[model samples]
Target chain A: MTTTVCGRCKSSGAVTDHQGRQDGAVVWTILRCPTCNFSWRDSEPARAIDPAARSVDFAVDADDLQRYPKILQQ
Target chain B: MNDLPNRARSISSLRDFLELLEDSGQAITWSDPVMPEPGVRNIAVAASRDANGAPAIVFDNITGYPGKRLAVGVHGSWDNIALLLGRPKGTTIRELFFEIAGRWGDQEAQISFVPEAQAPVHECRLEQDINLYDVLPVYRINEYDGGFYIGKASVASRDPLDPDNFGKQNVGIYRLQIQGPDSFTLMTIPSHDMGRQIMAAEREGVPLKIAVMLGNHPGLAVFAATPIGYEESEYSYASAMMGAPIRLTKSGNGIDILADSEIVIEAELQLGERELEGPFGEFPGSYSGVRKAPIFKVTAVSHRRDPIFENIYIGRGWTEHDTLIGLHTSAPIYAQLRQSFPEVTAVNALYQHGLTGIISVKNRMAGFAKTVALRALSTPHGVMYLKNLIMVDADVDPFDLNQVMWALSTRTRADDIIVLPNMPAVPIDPSAVIPGKGHRLIIDATSYLPPDPVGEAHLVTPPTGDEIDALSKRIREMQLGALS
Candidate 1:
């Protein structure tokens, strides 16, 4: 259908990155047309990236752990 | 196949990406004077203490570019991160991981355009090949940023080798080195899906068609750059979060146009060629080492009417990459573990500061906690960025920094915890084993069977509603300092 994309729709990618969703869902994919400003979601593929149990490291920021103390258990 | 040119969007257009922000309500404009480029990211720097804590900013009037626009702080808050996930606000990292673990990816979002169509981005196209420095207000984000490296990108291309890999192409976001208008260097981190795709095409002696998505919904960029499995499309995950399908359009001169994108810069990367690309601040909060990388030649550039080019900042503690990794990438790892062990409560993929890990899980058995710690190293995200992974009880939300430290302070016994040195790690992880490949130790910090045993902590909810509220108010408003 030939329709002009409203400037608002053509703004940017529809959503932000790594957003939370569902009652317990994570952001799968974030999209936007910038035309109809058509934006939506899609699940992240599990088999494609990070395919194997590849070894990597997780850097712990002490401050990040210290910020919300109450929920942290002893 | 679905007629009516669907020009492929480059997954990295700053201009087209902006329109998505205005429509989503995740961004707002500020009429403030353009702060110096590096100074602009302070908004995020100010809030990096916590993941998903920055606010998006738009610069209306810059020092040089009279009317051009610049956007910052795209994926700043957890709620905003949730917004990117298309979820109601306040979504936590744990919840996001559950969804990520369940992978359902998107096909391809392409953009198609006709010469007759006048797009807004054309309003001021530089008639002559202008220096990138002249057309836009480039920033000097950090002093060490050797030069202007457009740090964030969501690139898409088809694997020339296997036609089967075509259709389900993914959008991968990485960094780019903006050298001159016609040329730029591609810095696809090794083993990255996009890098793998290019390598595959080149290995077979084929041309890799590419679209560099400039800017758009900041959330989408997170999905683009994320290291999810390749089975599903990132856009589909985005769609699931938004509760709808992302709209797309056509723009590239070829058949692969993008849907609902900001702008698409088409180029072809032939395999096996290499060129040097970076010195920009990387996600590790350190300057990425430079080396020979692939160089692509732009065949054509297309965008929606008034395209706002997209840019992402990289610096200490937090950047869009860190947030994307933590929220979109790390959270899902927690969910995966939770599936096997329901008591595995929370997960936080910390930046490379402490450069270790703090996990919270209810200890069901004496060694159950350790098993959880070991399994953590196996999750997709965990294996990629952990050195010393600390396991805590359900009482802790791995997200709360203080809670985890308290566990380390009180419950952790150095001898009881296990340390496995030398394991593969990303280049930036400070505690990365082997500098890149070494083993990490796991600390079983959850309160072990102390004395006898207490019922699982998950079964402990002392109060509800008004009673809890009244107690908090009493603590704050009443002279209950002595009681505290």
Candidate 2:
């Protein structure tokens, strides 16, 4: 089986969240990274689904996800 | 509904308003197939640039999305705004501002509740095996946005502690980033009512239930973007704006929503859960950096048949965001200021969501203008976003930038500018050096009073008379005749 990696965080734990179907057939799958909660549709442009082509400005490091400020404190 | 005037009850749904736009030649339908990415966003951007006479564009043929329709720039121009208010296309911005301000006192506006069967929004329900992509024509609004966003929905949420208090319930517009088939994240600052509700929910360790209503009535959209009192009900204000009673129905979660909404997504903000969101194009014409926001899990989805997905392009200035929120923002501040100071004539806060404001007032004493400016800074919307304010004399028209500039140039003195440092500000403001804290500036551009005699001696007055008006009309007719 091929492993799906998250484009924004490059996390290997990316899992399929849902599928998009047009007629009776599935056209694309939405994959989400559990580490950073980043998601992308498989059929999207390479810039949005491929880590190497994605803009560095929006890329997130899974380990550094904790650094992002939480909007509200529990 | 019975007490409303004929014009106020004319438009009850988005489709009814769209029909009005068509009849008035204010909307167009694109029949050719176009890519959803750049096609929709680019068309919206081009239409928004006109700012005055842009028509709402409906893309009927979107590639890969058969039978799905997307409407853009529905409220992107003043002409469309005037049409929404049941006025002529040629209504001036000042006239429109006052029209809305005049209706601000309709706190007793009526709202009628309908049964689920009577609500058109409940025509279709997708409670099982739901996929947002399959239902909604979700597409990235901006190229670099982190994900597809529902930017134009009127999100309805109640104060968790006082869920039954209708007045405490809030209906406002907030950006929703679609993360999965049944999941999304919403962005709200601490100052917004939604933010306060979230804080309350978090403190109580409970999920915050919300019903996101899309493609709502134009009046609802206007009041949703408005900055009103925390306890004020947007539905009632929307009724006031429409001059008729607004029809509403309860969602699966018991949240009230527009009966004519094209789509309704019932969701809950999970407790103690945060997710990576944003880096989306924001209203400040810049991309909002990534932050951890609250995650929402969809519980049920309902919509009318063949739902028309409504979205907005919110990058930079002069977009629908400005036109949608501008006048509504100005009217409330004007109404609030007029309560304390009847000498205040007009207010213009159309620039970048009231970050800069202009006020015209009749100065009573030496420092009265400055006092009015300070009082404005305390208005509901002013406290957070009114960073720079310009004070003008009662003779000047705040809506007319030419007059405002003339006042700034001729009446302003170097010593009249006051700066208050480290004040609360809109976090998305790109000029904010420290995210949510910035300096406030007030320029007393009104002419000096008794103590100051400089430049108060000789001032040229503008000529005005009935003869001038008659000549102006004759000359305009002559010019048209010559062109023809």
Candidate 3:
């Protein structure tokens, strides 16, 4: 498992996966930051890895328009 | 007696504010060719968000209109507003509101009237064949919006019958929809000054003459958005803030307009003329359902030789429209609250698309917080659309949502919440029981009991001040990575 740092609060280990889905060649995920209570979306290239392989964490979320919430409720 | 420095008072015009932003490296100019659809609004929103409201955007080479430019996000952020108010870079929105409230009752400043020949807005007058859609590229931000919306329009009107209010015109910023080239629909609530003026004009058997000015100084827009007394002039307030007289020219119909404005649409609202107005995206980040509104018939259109069309992005939180409306309501309401409770420090009406108001005050008495909260709901500005009013201690910054939420969680109790039903309603609220009636809530988040015997303990610990300064400097030094 990889640990991600939140971009807003800059706190590590405070992010959790809200949802994840596989879309053809990419794996899309929505991550929520508990420190700032903000959510962002991310995507990674789909690949197969051994159970013992080390996972790389990303410092920022993926900037994809499709992954953004269509209606941002206030 | 002027207490503040001259530069800290007010800005001259919208162009002057843009120039100041460019000089301070707070504005970005886009020269690349782009279409009005999807491209202009997309880049404006992205640039504003990326900069965290630090930069205003100007699109110079729009696809169809080669020389004509469009500017947005000029007043989109707290930093830009602080700069415009001549405050420090890190000034909070609450602090700005306090300043405006402190200066709210200052004597009116003098304004100069210039002839039409001297006004830049009258450089090109189109009395015939005034095609608005062809002249300016009014882009649509939302896919479901009814049509092109003049989101930042400053509409001017006056009371024709009241002799005491002679020459005191109310300039308000309301959502205007372009129904046709020669006609428009204005969303004016009955409680607003403009609505009252319209009703007064109708009673006197005269059509309410109105003038909508666009692309003036940001200061003028701010003054117009504010709900000052009906007997006051928004132009005079703007002039006082600027520390200089604002130049104005009479329109063809005799209504005064900003001489430095980019465009002016002179129109009159005929009695008994109503049309379908909305379904346009409002500041609440939602589309206000369509409703019947008074239609404005355009009499004449005037503009500069090459004018820059201005628009404020709507349909979301943290947009320019919210900032404008929030500040306008907060400042005047704060002034009113201070009249009875001088301990009030700051107010944040920009909370939750301005439907919620968070006011912080230095509580000297036990029930002072409740008094302030109730007074906030009774003000003319507050009674209109402020549905949720919360009061907190002076230590809390109302503009910071995190602090406000902390206060709500720690200081508020369910038993202490005051619920008043069947109050005057906000027409745009989707949850209103009827057209003009709704419930009001007041949350007294301030501490009621005395301090602990020894001392109250601080629960949460933030980073040290020095550490925060070092982190900020390090982040400033690092180059931003490219985004996809």
Model 1, position B181, has a per-residue lDDT of 50
- Best by the DockQ measure: 2
Error of 2 at B414 (Å): 2.3
CA lDDT, candidate 3, residue B237: 83
TM-score of chain A of 3: 0.41
After TM-score superposition, what is the CA distance of residue A28 in candidate 1 from its true location, in Å? 42
lDDT of 2 by residue, B134-169 (tens): 778766788778778899989999889999999999
Docking quality level of the chain pair in candidate 2: acceptable
User: Of the candidates shown, which would achieve the greatest TM-score relative to the real structure?
Assistant: 2
- Report the TM-score of the second chain of model 3 against its true counterpart: 0.89
lDDT of 1 by residue, A45-74 (tens): 222112132112211122332321111011
- How high is the lDDT of residue B233 in model 3? 83
What lDDT is reached at residue B337 by model 2? 96
Candidate 1 yields a Cα-based lDDT of 0.54
Write the residue-wise lDDT of candidate 3 on B114-230 in tens digits: 899888889999888665654565665654454567888898776667533635778988888776556777887777787777667766677678788888878888778777777
Worst lDDT 10-window in candidate 3 chain B: B1-10
**Model 3 regions lying over 4 Å from their true place:** A1-74, B1-11, B50-52, B162-167, B450-484
Task: Give the total clashing residue pairs for model 1.
Answer: 151
